[model samples]
Target: MKTGSTYLQFLAAAALAGQVVSAETIAQINGNKYLSPYNGKNVTNVNGLVTAKGPSGIWIRSTAPDSDERSSESVYVFDRNFGKNLTVGDVIQLNGTVTEYRSSKAYVYLTEIINPKLVQKISSGSAATPRVIGKDTLSPPNKAFSALDNGDVFGVPNNVSLISVSNPTLVPRNYGMDFWESLSGELVTVKSAHALTKPNNYGDTWVVGDWKVTGLNSRGGLTTVDKDANPEAIIIGSPLDGSKNPAITRVGDTLGDITGIVSYSFGYYTILPLTALNVVKAIEPRLPPPTTLISSGDCSGLTVGSYNVENLWAGSAHLVNISDHIVNYLRSPNLIFVQEIQDNNGETNDAVVTANLTLTTLTSAISSIGGPEYEFVEIDPVDDKDGGAPGGNIRQAYLYNPDILQLRKPNFGASTEANEVLPGPELKYNPGRIDPQNPAWTASRKPLVAEFETLDGKNSFFTINVHFGSKGGSSSIEGDARPPVNGGVEDRQEQMELTANFVADILAEDKNANIIVAGDFNEFAFVEPLENFLAISNLRDMDEAANIPQLERYTYLFDMNSQELDHMYISQALKPKAQYEHVHINTWVTLAEQISDHDPSVAKLNVCKK
Candidate 1:
């Protein structure tokens, strides 16, 4: 070991030779902005206590925390082999270069120390108590995600700017991202953690702590309303100690408490736990009873159901669960609007476009379960033309109980043919595709429209089943984009415009036409596309007409919010008698227990003339 004077002389000589030996405080390196101040600069003699260790690296927190809340006092040291011998509570001194790391352009950068030249354990057994996150200590902001975003994270015109390039100053008290950034790499404890979503495939789970939150729904999950996206929730990533997180987590399940290091990964701020988390209080299984709005078994009214079976085919294993959901949970409605019915080959891409075998399997399954022996109608799309799983050729179809209704003018339209409304206020071809060749519907599912008449032929109604373009390429709510890109919004908007025009033509011929449009729109009810559709068609959302609470109107759960992507709309003449209910067969269950990603909905309406 060299003497202090000798070491000083050596350091001086190294600096003179262009080797940097500058020392930096963790706070100074972190800075007050999104990016680090000392990034790409060599740092020496950085002292901190090893608060946590993981497979890839170790987290060190400064013993002398600064008064400024904008600067973090901790940072990750990226070196898998260097941290293998290190343990928590070991005070260590390291020399490295500060760097800002991100997995992709869509994610915010994480301030870290990389290319470590030296790591020396100065002492052992030093205790570093984690800061508890609660009412008194470091409560996360509940409403907004970023101050950079004006008010809503889901606003339109996304990808306008990136947070990393701007590197705005931190506002920890007002924004959730800033608050989490303030604690990056620091060990913190979350109390009374309730799961916001089920564990994903990698066993990562999102949870909300006991704090003030907005859009709290009846099921204890946060909801995405007009402006709030529940920014207080955080995801619990894989444990730092190389242990698996609980895989059977469900929304609203209590996790008791979790102690972990705050880090950024995969487009969201994550908390990598020091160890595995246990289910402290499991929520009771919410197996909703069958819908109460059953068919009246007459011509006065009809009960209709809408469900997205999630790319189902004749041989799909989920067929049983889906049939159970429709027969038992939805109470066997008079008509069912189903989307994502794959061709008979089930993603084989053999140029076969028919789904006859697929529908027969489902209708047979329903009858086997002691339900209605339904008749199905659909216009198959050109192979691989619709957007879905590449070979699936997914499309929408209608399943109607022949005992209650029949197609009035049963002329099935071809794949590329466009349906029209004639002078009789009737579909030119029953079970026809609407604007199938429109550019707005390029590589997307087309709308399936049909006119139905009661058995007595005294009452007639029309229905349109649509599965619009998906939000596939959308950015994350907490991503760098200000408003976050809602993928396929333009195409979906145009598709809605075309469909609304068709509805307009029908209403032009008959002002009091009884029409119901329902399916997996793959959009929020409050967003521009659906809102524009409702405005143009003069249709009322069934959820609103039925007086469903705003918080209870969700049919899907994603990220931190329970949202509605599936909807049912009725013309003004049918709104007064509409009654709706969302059967939570999928969303309320664990990921393993769910048959599909979306919940099904039922609506009862009077189709007969009043």
Candidate 2:
């Protein structure tokens, strides 16, 4: 009999010999978890078939795939030079170290083999066919984004933990992220793909295929209904064969079929196509008819509108288009709450802090189009104090038809002066900033409060125009962080609290005050900040009051979902007779026809009913 130490050494040597004799398959290298089990380990003689070759490297698929649905049969090899001698349908074996790669912490890692060396080309001339995503292969799950998100991807206190660290097993049939992760590096084809958004600057287009999807609007684009963000959609990135993608594609346009390699880049899972995709069916260039909620032309009814003009300057070329949208599509509401009105000099940091010229130019354009000759009121922000494009000094303003509405008390306050509600349910300053010195408004636009009345001064109501802090610094929805970070949420919450308190003071003075709070809140209605604001202020969202269908209530389109960023809220007094419509002038048109990223909205209310 041998000693115990000698016996252990013999067992270790036997195991090492077994490892040297066995070759790893692609499925074995990619385990069921988010991270590979063999990460950071050097392996020899990995066998696969060369599926596709691009400028970066080649994709290889296992000849003998396992029955595990969670394990991908293909993977990318990151070697810029090694793929030059390779071609599709060549069976090969390679030696490399398994690595998990991501450009930053905000993105999920792509399982890859780096520093690869081709050991053998086993065979060539075999057929390389891509698996059809929704037909022959498994379809992407439609409901949830990630199981790691605890049922709500937009919940607060985000970035609490990372999916990378947890490395949970994938549930490919339920979660969207898991479904895509299961096919990480596979060659797949999307059939009858329809564009979900306009192509980005890099020519990447978001699209949903013939697969079953939820929240599909009548316009052939997906909308955010309830908790679903439409995870069945995927983005089509640049072509691997180095061709230019169509730049003028619009939402609802069709790209017939796409065959590409599934990969992750720029915080989203994308398909790098084999060649450029052309628009097989182009959408019509006509815009939807103007809103039906026209002005009542008297104190019996009030027609109000809200739009974020996207940093309008006095001499911007798109002024005519924007004026046309406001006149024809929005029906030229009696009062319009507009945001992003830049200074007269337009983005010059020379201490010129007035927007009179910009507002006049827009009003003149509207009048020239046979629309209302609107009068405007605003408090110019301190030079460069507001956060937007640097030196832009964007602020919120009111554009009202003087024949229908007028300022109740024409006392405009200075930029930094805080407005207060007095005993008469009136603002101390007619058009004033709301709590400008508060930390919540730091580097953000302050709320503009103005008291309005019918031309006869018989019925009075209050309006607050707000452009809250933006959603900058937010993490990607498909990022590693669970319940991804919503940047500026805390500040938005504080800002909402202050605005609600101001509303409370008005209610405290007169419980039946007719107040209409509207503008770009910069947060979704279902999110925490807006929810808290609605809860505290007792303001009703006009969309609900108007009974707009759940699928049609959107004013902006981004990524894979058509969502609402501009909103109009009403006090309890105006909720009884509010009617609203979202004019889809921008969202339904091609990117070249869009004057602003946001679509304008119109609402008709009976402010004098009570």
Candidate 3:
């Protein structure tokens, strides 16, 4: 046939030109290692089948696979102007220099070839079969990231180091990051992938294919069981075919089979799909169960709630919605610890520290919703010293139903001064700030401790509401540090130590002191600071006391993981009969419906008995 004759003539013409045809393949250039040995060297007459193309270049796969798991059989050819002309399935020969591209400040390095000296379109319509995953291909390793991410522990001080400085050899099976790096630029297919995280503004999501996964919650996403909760998961990026991905996705949405090239971006291993993804099946979100018992201030017990209102000022929005959540979801507890209550003027920076308007507005909203007329008490912070929304003098406060538990008033102290815990029946002030003048309290919200007596006038309990220093100033999770520096961790530790010392002082006076420490500690329950608090006189986290599943205990969503930032730790005396309910009124819902970043939680403690 004429086609066969033409192919023979083409081969003859190539032999006469001495062009060194069929010299190398893409696999040779991409060895099973972090850095390429052929890097900075000129590669000549590399033949490949173009599987996909983008604005920057084309991803070419080896027509003759090397069949090596350690080496990638595909590579990216950088020829922006000429790449746009190439079509999928086109067999091409490229001559270029291989280079490792570091995307940004992140330490990940992507191996790619650039500045093609020759881009010969040998033939069109070549077969480009994507390597099907979850069928016969190798599954992702079950545990740890590469040595680069340091194994089993990423955020500990002992393992922190830079990959660039070490350039450690790749151990693809040991770590998720290294596994994806080994397959970089390779065209692969992930069959039946389920979304592990909700789509962000960019329509990017983390997903796991048909493979075994650890910490698989009932909702399908991985949770914090140990540390490496998401070993089989990878992020899916925007499609290169110029189509929008699906909207209204949740954690358990079935994102069907995804065929794409492996990539690294924004400190995560990613996949660039060839086409936009369509949801195969959607699972309705499982809402949290309502609190069992509503509080009516019976002498039998006291119910307490804690929440960060997210900068609630006098004229701020979401006032009604927040109050609604409190009344309906939180069940209108007897005493509620609230944080981020702004000054009367909101974020005006006018040096006014009082939040009478803000508190009154919220209380009025609660009463309007058929809830009790709760009275609030707080010691306002100095101008903007506490870190939060600028000019919004955010501080902690207590809102209690007068009919349930009355505040035991004590001699008030100056707002700037600290209120020491006296021996019995009285704090320096009834609802007063603790250690406000301590250097540890500088630029942070001081713990608000208050003494309350049951309406029956029998027993009294002390509660310390605190919002510790946030994780600002922490290094990037993908930075060179192994256990990335948790910014403001030391400050938060000192804050917890100071609060614990105050509780210790109270216990010294009364050995069986009924005390509760509750608020946004801004650290994980397993973190060192909280561990230090647990060692203090047997204070137990309500999560453990209430027997909530470790994977199901989360009050805030940050990055890819659901974490518990807001917590309530009860004294040893209250742990036996205490029942805590995490009202998931905010975190799992859509961002637009969120009144605050944190979900409010209620705990019923037998303060009267214990």
Taken over the whole model, the C-alpha lDDT of each candidate is 0.86, 0.87, 0.77
Clash numbers, per candidate: 0, 0, 8
TM-score of 1: 0.95
Model 2 misplaced stretches (Cα beyond 4 Å): 1-23
Residue pairs in candidate 2 whose N, alpha carbon or C atoms collide under 3 angstroms: none
What's the TM-score of every candidate structure? 0.95, 0.95, 0.90
lDDT (Cα, tens digit) per residue for candidate 2, span 1-610: 0125554354335434433323468888888988988776666889888888888789999998888988999999876778898889999888876778787888999998766778999999988889899776788999888877788888887888798998889888898888888898899999999898888887899998989999888787898866678889899999988998898888889899999999888788889999988899987755777899888898667899999999998988888888988888888899999999998878787888899999999999999999999999999998888899887889999999998999998899998899999888778999998999888999999999999999888899999999999999989888888888888999999999999989888988988899999999988888889999988888889999999998898889888889998889999889887899999988988788889989889999987837
lDDT of 3: 0.77
Best by lDDT: 2
Q: Rank the candidates by TM-score, best first.
A: 2, 1, 3
Candidate 3 C-alpha lDDT tens digits along 319-380: 88889888888888999999999999888878788999999999999999988899988887
> Which 10-residue span in candidate 2 carries the lowest summed lDDT?
14-23
Error of 1 at 460 (Å): 1.5
Q: Between which residue pairs do clashes occur in model 3?
A: 145-175, 146-175, 154-483, 155-483, 156-483, 160-482, 161-482, 474-487
Residues 1-610 of candidate 1 have per-residue lDDT tens digits of 0124554354445434444546557888898999987776778899899998877788899977788988889999876677878888998888877777776789889998766655678999999788888643567898888877788776666677789888989998889999999989989999888888888889898888878788888787888887678888899999877899988888888898899999988889999988887888877866766789989987665999999999999999999989988899998999999999999989897888899999999999999998999999899998888989988999999999999999996999999999999998888889898989899998899999999889888888999999999999988887888778899999999999899989988999998999999998988877888888988898888988999999888888888779999999889889876799999888888888999999999998888865
TM-score for candidate 2, please give it: 0.95
